[model samples]
Target: MDDGAERIFAALRDVSQSGAPLYLQLKKNIEEAVKRGLIGPGDALPSERDIAAQADISRVTVRKAVQDLVKSGVLVQRHGSGTFVAPRMERVEQSLSRLTSFTEDMARRGMAARSQWLDRGIYTASPDEMMVLGLSASELVSRLSRLRIADETPLAIERATISASVLPDPHEVTSSLYMALGKTGHRPVRAVQRISAVNLGEAEAQLLAVPIGSACLQIERISYLASGKVIEFTKSIYRGDAYDFVAELRLPGPDGQEGEAT
Candidate 1:
């Protein structure tokens, strides 16, 4: 490393030992440095190895710190080059358990919903998909891949798989698939969903305006009709910063009466 780089690394390390987690402290130190004119926006960051050696911390810590900044749109990583600060943008989030469409959810919050359709097509089903929708191998399924937005802020990317027998025309779906299903007497009254945390890939981060490899929420939902038939299966990725899923629970009363209060 050059003298300038070594000095920069030492200064960053000194700033990082302030009782905060190493990664967060590193991020804050760099941002403060930039704000104070120590580094400009387009300036390249010290390599992870270089930062680790100077900081006397693990390379993993440096990588995590850089990745967090990237996810926050504070840093940008150029393949085969290095990491630098990112330009500004907005980030959006949606609750995973809401049984509403992107439009409806956003509207309730006084935001407008928009979509960029990545895919809309019909194809033969995967075994898991077929089993979930109760379709045969010969049956067709419609797939809709969309980036959902509110007030032009990307919230999530949803890839919904539907049984063609349930929804033969994808064009008829203008907004919420849930509402469309209700119109056709196939609306799901209940659903089972799973949630997991993961890091975003380059494509997802670019589309959602988050840093590549940033933490996100992955949700998989299977919604069922009143008759207990699965009507739809959807997979969505939500920005971790902006979303929180809450549920209200109840149990039978002491008198053996079922709880009824909402």
Candidate 2:
């Protein structure tokens, strides 16, 4: 064990005196070491055998602590490789005052953005989609579902729907949906969006590479054209730890009146 590892295990002395469980005490010590920068991201952790031998604790205790850390996004365990501290997640700030596409937003922030298409096709409109898009039962809706990535990090899962009349071919939307809509003269001028807190399910967790039940933001949006026609409906799931929605606020003037935030 390195000196840093020794420092991390030093707190194990008199574990019986600590009110917490032995594994919990060891967990706390490991967290403290991480906070103090004694162990950095991607730094390999000593094996369970080594840790048990050095800390004078059972391997079961060490395993429990490490598993907890992994679930908390503190540590990562590769199949054949040993455990290591997870790399830091970069948080992104998005302006709520502006309606922007993920590609445009990332471009504004100077981060490379890309998408992996999940599902794209013209399908019979579902009841919810028909209601949201103002389509009749006879009409179809183009559906586009994709994983949005920024700087190679999976940031969100976006699924959008549009009336086939407005967007006949989902294939036209290669990158930015707005750009594709603009070409068809159906781009939206404004939108109404609602955001809610949600927990990731099994499939969503796997796609996002985070623990199940991880907190995330769920957003539903309706985009309108200049003529007040609903042109698009979109739902998105964003990683809570990697994004912050910022809305600029101002105090009312002497008249107790406030203008639009923008």
Candidate 3:
């Protein structure tokens, strides 16, 4: 076992006065180790069998403890890989007043940005996509799904759909979908976003490195061109704890009316 694992075992063995469940005790001990820098972020953890054998605890207990930590955002588990400390993330504020791509938004904040391609293909438009992007049943739509990251932190999952006539090849989108659409002279000049508060589902939580049922912001956007033709329909999920959506407000000067609130 590595020194970190040895420290974790020592910490667990030293807890003699606690009345908490074994899993809970181990959970707190492991969390303290993380806080004390015994296990640094991105450091792979020892296997469950190793921890259980060395700590003299049941593997079930170890699993439960690790699961709790994973849900609490203290640890992250990659498929086919051991669990590791979760990466630290700085909270970000985004303006809702302007239309911009994820690349543009992250660049403005001076954060290096990148995307993990989850999907890029041409497929038959779904019913919702048909209505949102004004597509026909027989018409195909280009799909672009990506995990948007800024400064090595996964911030959002963006999935966009556009008519094949407008975007025949989803793979053409390199960084920004808006930029790719601009090449075809079909970029949207305006967009409408519907934002809602929700809990993260299992798939989304895993992708965003948050616990299942963690707070999230679900946004659906429809984009339109200057000619009033719909061009894009996109859905995005953002980590609520790491993002704050801000919009400027104004009151009408000449009439009893309110300004736009995104």
Candidate 4:
């Protein structure tokens, strides 16, 4: 067995006992190794077969233990690559009560934000776009698609559509789309967002440097101006392990008063 397998065995020996399932004991052994600094982030773990042999446990148990760690974000598996300790990432907390751009959100946390543009141009509004943006069949819309990065780590894939009247040239948006719209007095002041969980597909997984089928948060947002005109329609996928969305709630008053406190 290799050094990593040997270490795993040693850790397993230290914690192995009767009564509990072997897989659970192995899982605890791995966690303890990580806590004691025996295994650090990005360190490759022993293969399932190797771990099973060294720990004298069934391969099925080893596999289950590893999979559980993956689901818990304690480990990461790369396609054609062995499992490894997950890289430590700073989780970003986003407030559901604010209408802020991704750039603005990162800026608030003093993190540098950048984008890799994938698509930018005007296209005939699709039926869905037309319905959402209140555009006619003949009207065109500007589309901007990009991979958003924070501190050089890929965080999200964002595709935003705006009325051509609001943004004549998508290419003009070199950084923040909201900033570009502000110049034309079409920046949205409010937005409604719906969030759901999805498994990353191959293309998006590759772009985000995550394994295929990794969990992610998919968000669809419609931004509106003070006049209630839809200014932007956006769809975004954020890394599940790297973001937290928070919302503050207030208790109702004696008379059942609710809504933002005055």
Candidate 5:
């Protein structure tokens, strides 16, 4: 065994005597190694058989321990490749009550945000887009699709649609769509968003560098101007492991007290 594997085996040996279940003990040992930077992210783990033989434990114990870590996002398994530690990802906490662009939010967190444009052009509004944006079938809409990145890490995919009259040219939007709309004096003042959990498809998983069928957050948003006109309709998919949506809640007050819900 190499020095790294030797160190891991030594750590495993130290935990084998603990009263905890063998699998739990093994899991804890691996976690401790990661915490101490003995095994950094993306480091390949020993094969189950090799680990079991060296640790004097059953292969089942190692498998169970590894599977647990995979579910907890500490490890990842590739179909053709061996299991490895998951890449460290920054978990962004987003406030559901606020209307902020992805660029603005990342800027507030001191992270550089950028977008890779997938498609941007004027297109006929689809039936769903027409319904959501309150557009007619004949209306042309500026469609913008992009892969959002923060600090060079892929974070989400966003597709937005707005009336052509509101956004005359989609190509003019080099970065934040909201910023582009601001120049037209049509930036949305408020937006309604619905969030749902989904299993990402193959394409989405590949784009996000995650395993197929990974859990993701699907969000649909309709933004309105001060005049209550639907200004934008957007659909986005975010990596579940990298984002947390937070909302403040308050209990009911006394009678005649007004409380706002966000």
Candidate 6:
């Protein structure tokens, strides 16, 4: 093992005297090391067997700890290659007031964005769909699924559902769904989105070129037009290692700030 790995093992052993679960202890130690700059982003980590030998722990314990780190976005595993520290993600700037598309976002970042159409068709609404999209039983729903790419890297899988009456034809839609909707006078003016974390499954891992059970960002978004019409609802899974969502907070102007409650 290298110097960094040796230090990691020693620190973990020293901090684990309280006898916490081995895997959790290892995780905590590594996180602290990262925070303290002993480990930096994009550093290569020791292999499982190497770490096990260095720490005098079982290989299973090492595996569990490494896998947990991979699932939490702290590490990344490359197929046919070894695991490494995850790259730092650039914060994504989103205007909470406007409905935007992945292509548009990438363009603003000065990267070429692309999408592979997976499945597209019209279907009747299910009970869950009716609640999510505010659709009626008789209304036709269009589902568009795509694998999103930016700068030639696969970044996310997106599925969009909307009223067929709004889109009319699915094939006419291309790169940016928002742009397409704008052309039809049904552009979304506002949206509500919920964000969460998930572990990538085998299929998603294959598509995103990450290890199975890797961390991902799950976002569900519902957009509305000014007429109180539900324009579209979308669910997206973003590669956790490659994306960061950010929100900027501002203090109130001087007088209001002074009167703010603690």
Q: What are the lDDT figures for the candidates, one per model?
A: 0.79, 0.85, 0.86, 0.87, 0.87, 0.79
Taking all chains together, each candidate's TM-score versus the true structure is 0.64, 0.70, 0.83, 0.68, 0.69, 0.62
Q: Identify the superior model by TM-score, candidate 1 or candidate 5.
A: 5
The CA-based lDDT of model 4 is what? 0.87
Kindly state the number of residue pairs that clash in model 1.
Answer: 0
Q: Candidate 5 on 88-207: residue-level lDDT in tens?
A: 897999999899999999999999999989899999989998898888888999999999988766799999999998888899998888898998899999999999999988788767
Candidate scoring better on lDDT of 1 and 5 = 5
- In model 6, state the lDDT of residue 188: 90
Which ranges of candidate 4 are over 4 A from the true structure? 1-87, 254-256, 259-262
Candidate 6 lDDT by residue in tens digits, 1-262: 5787766666666434467988888888777877787777767787788777766778898889888777656777767788776666554555644456888888888988999899888888778778877877898888899999876467899999888988768877878888989998988988888999999998888677677888989999988899987788889998887787775456576666634333
Runs off by more than 4 Å, candidate 3 = 1-10, 15-21, 36-50, 58-61, 78-82, 255-262
Model 2 clash tally? Answer: 0
lDDT (Cα, tens digit) per residue for candidate 4, span 75-109? 77767988887777889999999999999999999
For residue 256, what is the lDDT in candidate 4? 92
Candidates 3 and 4, the one with greater lDDT: 4
Predicted structure 5, TM vs. truth: 0.69
Scored by TM-score, the top model is: 3
Q: What is the C-alpha RMSD of each candidate to the true structure, in Å?
A: 8.7, 5.3, 3.6, 6.7, 7.1, 8.0
Candidate 5, number of clashes: 0
Sequence-dependent TM-score of model 3: 0.83
Candidate 2 lDDT over residue span 1-262, tens digit each: 5775665556444345358887888778777778888787777788898788777889999899888877667777767888887777899998888888899999998989999899999999999999988888999999999999887567899999999998888998999999999887998999998999999997887566578899999999999999999999999999999999998897676688986543
Lowest summed lDDT over 10 consecutive residues: which window, candidate 4?
A: 8-17
